[model samples]
Target: MDIDLTAARVVLLGRPGCHLCDLARDVVQQVVAETGDSFAEAVVDEDPVLLERYAEQIPVTFVDGRQHDYWRVDPVRLRRALAR
Candidate 1:
């Protein structure tokens, strides 16, 4: 899901032992570096409810409290999302 940076509030749902989640974390950090926008990271396993809710969809990305991407990070879309 593409997001508008002017109003974007991103959250990365991640957990340990997840390669894709690690990659997503890197991508989000890079996006922050290039765009200077803030984002949040939520470790699903840290919260059992979150873990159960997002276990199959680790590394989920949300923009403005809405689901954007999952499983993998899409840099192109992310850049567009962060470009205001």
Candidate 2:
């Protein structure tokens, strides 16, 4: 499905083979599913800029293009973000 640009974004940034990243993705997916919000995934290892910026902070989540969460996803905060 195509995402609406105006909608809030749930960005999951992580690398392969990271268990924590996988868990973070799952939490993000759950939040998006509950809120029916737009979602995007960024592979830090593939993007030079993201790699440098989030090299040590994989599993980061961004809401509306702003850094929202890192290391873990907060479902309550995510839902509230979507509501706004």
Candidate 3:
């Protein structure tokens, strides 16, 4: 509840009733526990533009405002991105 609000900027693009999206959210929560970094969630379905752009890729992840991961999260790749 009192974690650092700076360290990394992450945005998760997901939709309701998507299991993969749920998984991605869990992954981000776990990473936050380990990294003490701030994390935010964005439901792509809320925005027409984002929904249109990522309709196929439900669990899209963006780090520092740039696309970093998608569909499935590669733990090694995620760690590397955070280390940057």
Candidate 4:
């Protein structure tokens, strides 16, 4: 399925085999579930632009199409952002 990341309320940028990405996914999933928000995951390695812009920031999280956090996701902060 083709997911429009821009339209998603939350976007997760990361590559496979990333431990941090795994953790971030879990937190994002939990927060979005509670907030009734939706999210999309984009593998940085799959897109050159995403890789270039966020290669060093795997596990990056974007809320409302704006960069929100990286390396780690704080559920409280994410919930707060979604509430905005």
Candidate 5:
């Protein structure tokens, strides 16, 4: 698939209608904006691989390809992660 690698400096996986996911995204966005980081938002249900791996863990955060947090995105920790 054609993709924008730079768009995913921070990856957030979630599904629509998930409150925790919504909350996490908001938290992530705040941290990203503060740190001037690029980000990718993925609806887990849209990708079989991600859906299978993260179906039960809707709001997952990844920093530079490594899992960072889940369920709830921590703004302080996210800021720290992005600063790295």
Candidate 6:
């Protein structure tokens, strides 16, 4: 699948079989459901640049193409960011 990162307001960088990524995905889905924003997932291991930059931060969250959070997704903070 082709993910248009530029069009997505939220981008999730993760790899397969990642526990943290799974948790983050749940949080992201909940937040976006409430906020009516769209999100996309990119496999860090699939892209060299993403893998290099986020290998240690598999569950990274990006809002508007800028880094938002890593390891975990804070619902309150995410709601605040989306309101911006």
**lDDT for residue 32 in candidate 4, whole number 0-100:** 84
Candidate 6: worst-modelled 10 consecutive residues by lDDT: 1-10
In Å, residue 75's CA in model 4 sits off its true spot by 0.9
Clashing pairs in 4: none
lDDT of each: 0.77, 0.76, 0.74, 0.87, 0.80, 0.88
Model 5: per-residue lDDT, tens digit, 1-84?
122223588988887899998899888888878888888987777777777777887788888888888888878888888887
Q: Which portions of model 6 miss their true places by more than 4 Å?
A: 1-4
**Candidate order by lDDT, highest to lowest?**
6, 4, 5, 1, 2, 3
**In candidate 5, which residue ranges exceed 4 Å CA deviation?**
1-6
Ranking by TM-score: 6, 4, 5, 3, 2, 1
Candidate 3 lDDT by residue in tens digits, 1-84: 122213248777787889998998888877766767667877776777777877898798887777888897766677678778
Backbone clashes counted, model 6: 0
Error of model 1, residue 42, in angstroms: 0.7
What is candidate 6's local distance difference test score?
Answer: 0.88
Question: Per-residue lDDT tens digits of candidate 6, residues 1-84?
Answer: 244455589999888899999999999999999999999998887777777777998799999988999999999999999999
lDDT of 4 by residue, 2-78 (tens): 33457689999888899999999999988888888988998888777777778998889999889999999988899
- Over 1-84, each residue of candidate 2 has an lDDT whose tens digit, in order, gives 132222347777778888888998888888888888888776777767677777787788888877888887878887887789
Off by over 4 Å in 3: 1-8
Number of colliding residue pairs in each model: 0, 0, 0, 0, 0, 0
How high is the lDDT of residue 72 in model 6?
A: 98
Report the Cα lDDT for candidate 1: 0.77
Residue 3, candidate 2: how far off, in angstroms?
A: 16
Better of 1 and 3 by TM-score: 3
Which of the predicted structures, 1 or 5, would earn the higher TM-score when compared with the native?
A: 5
Candidate 3: what lDDT? 0.74
